[model samples]
Target: MGEKRLNERVLSPEEFVSGYQYITEYLKAGLPLCDVLKRALKYFEDQFVDSYCTIMLLNSKGTEFVNGAAYSLPDDMLEKFMHIRLFDGLGTCGTAAVRGELMVSPNVHNDRTWRSFANVVKPYGLKSCWSVPVFKPGTSDIVAIFAVYSKYSRYPTQRELDTLSAYNELLGLIVSNYKIDDSGEIEQLDLNEDDNLNSKTLYVESIKTGLKNGEIYPYYQPVLKSDGQELHGVEALARWEHPEKGLVPPIDFVDHAEEYDFIDWLDEVICRRACEDMKKLMDDTGKTFTLSVNISAVHIRKQNFAQRIEDILDETGFPADCLAIEITETSLIDNLTEVAVTFQQLKNLGVKIAIDDFGTTYSSLNYLKYLPVDTIKLDKTFIHDVDKSPIDRRICKTIIQLGSDLELDVVAEGVECDQHLSIIQDFGCNIYQGYYFSKPLTLEGWKNYLEQF
Candidate 1:
């Protein structure tokens, strides 16, 4: 059979009614606006196969779109739509928002407005785009833009447009009824909050303030050679020095940052600070040390992510070759292809890539084959019990051997005790990072520690 035509598949009335109920129930239950939009887009995409949908909410100033939620679009593509101006001849969504009308581009290639974004969407095989401006309830003011993209080059049928228009109204109601806070938390216009919820909201706001005030900073954890205890590198761990709390651990704020989609900002701050500090340390000590920094998956998914790293390097005078980006195993598996592309981009700049918390995720081995990873920091779980558990010992041995076969450096984490170090040494893993050697230290503490070393 030939390929299915885009116009032939119309959203049925039953499907529309079911989706409407589902989305309304989510809103009534006080779900996050982004989550609700995702569900709605997923429902629509399910109805129209090979299609993707996105909802871009207008910023408070109504100058640009922000906080976009897309069902199938990659983060990089969705990012391009963020902060897009409300202007005609800009793109489907932008033009729709500007004109407050439905904008259709049967073929993006032939459309003049799509020229700016053609290169970005082309790689994803998105050929057709139809966008509708979602207005605030009982007002002509556009609060959001709901866009549909298809792989095929064909205009949406009248039935399809009608279905989209109905969904657009539903989106308007959802967008107008809720307000997204600075922390990305969605709250209804007239919703009551519990004490715990209020506490969480306060903490999230504190994190935002901490970032601006420079309370959130990097703490260095030494990575040493297991054989000779010689410092091989240092991993930059985020630490918050709150005035009232004294010192707040990442356990308290990192998850909250990720939850609120502010991790990217936090990650950049840590990366930049780490680079600047490391540069000074290197210059003062007259020695070069590898600086490894943990990057959240949320930050890595941004468009031109590597370029951002390069910008930091250029600004701080940190050599790319001496920097290693440590990404957790789970992060790599979430979007392997896109992450691999990012890894390669980093590699091109001579920055090393290491799979942090390796062996925690099932797809660790699979990722090694595809990713241009330079090091494998075996998860602490395997090393913590390697001395007591025979299974863990064997797994550690296998990972070290696998790393050897792949010619990649294997760093054993949680080598706190002599027994843990001995076992990993026997397994032929050389790099070590854990509390037995040194805990993550403050900037001044790191300087003192280095002087003592």
Candidate 2:
């Protein structure tokens, strides 16, 4: 096979930061190592053109490679990788594992190291391969191999290699902290949680400063009527504006805040900021709009949770009746009785309550029977495929009916197109929120968006 030269592309600094932040969020969320690896690869593949990525682990004896995760690679090819032993010139990944360094084959056909895998890769038209060994942190022990494949033969620029190296380090952190069980479940090892937090104390402190500096604030995503003709409300989402990293996504740090037992502080900051912003928006626009804020389970379970919310309303002068507190189904699993008490207290203050991401957890429908919920936002997973999947459509229709029978507002989440809107309308869901209307926007962006209406 002849070599085919292709234009080289490198990941921008912003792209690198965003991708790293995105994957770190999953790791912090305690997702399975394999699932996190797959998502990490997907992020890279989406950034690069015609690229595929895979991760393979070193066995306990460090003798052979085992499947960890692969993106868009055929099972037969992945099966071949399982038998690759660590040795010189065995294959790109195998050789990288043995040498404990990065390996590159600009053209697999011309690289003698890939001679043994020629037949295996030919079917997929894999022209180039780059492999980097992921070592255990603070040690030279090889734990995993991260590889990227391309259909066109070309050498990667230095910048591209640097990006790979940066991500390789992150993979090391993930792999070193997690392990796969015999039942194929990803279980977290008994790593000392306190030690982990102590190690990242600077990061935690930075968040505290970030809030005081106004670096952490609220962004709003509009929730519209099912007809897409009028704005029903807006959801306040927290975002971190890192001075150097630009916009750090909430996923990257929200869980970290929760783990460090300071989520209550962060939640209060967001709620107060959102109330102030929404109050101003309502005043300027002369249009009353409901404001929804997601409260962490940690904060909601407190003995004085309702009192704190009432204080923020009093401080910001935001009407209590026009505000909604969205609680996820998973949050209600632990302390339903206590949470219901808080819900009733808030309801007594004229605040509305909403069950966000409803149907994602195993919590019984008895929640609706006991809790004072005014709305249930159907989990986006059901709405995402409502236009195509019969099962999703049925679930959405059933949820809408249930909401109606209970005389509660039903808001469909994740309506991204006209088809989703039409189908949701048919199901009699009059409230909608999703990218179909607009993505979450900064305060200025939200102001501009509302001005148009």
Over the full model, what C-alpha lDDT does candidate 1 score relative to the true structure?
0.80
Clashing pairs in 1: none
Segments in model 2 whose C-alpha atoms lie over 4 Å from true places: 1-199
For candidate 1, lDDT tens digit of each residue in 160-270?
665665455467767876885433355667545423443454456566667766788999988889463577889999999997889999999998888755677788889
Off by over 4 Å in 1: 1-196, 226-228
**For model 2, how does the per-residue alpha-carbon lDDT over 263-310 read when each residue is reduced to its tens digit?**
777888889999999998898889898899999888799678999899
Clashing residue pairs for model 2: none
Best TM-score among the predictions, by candidate number: 1
Best by lDDT: 1
Clashes of each: 0, 0
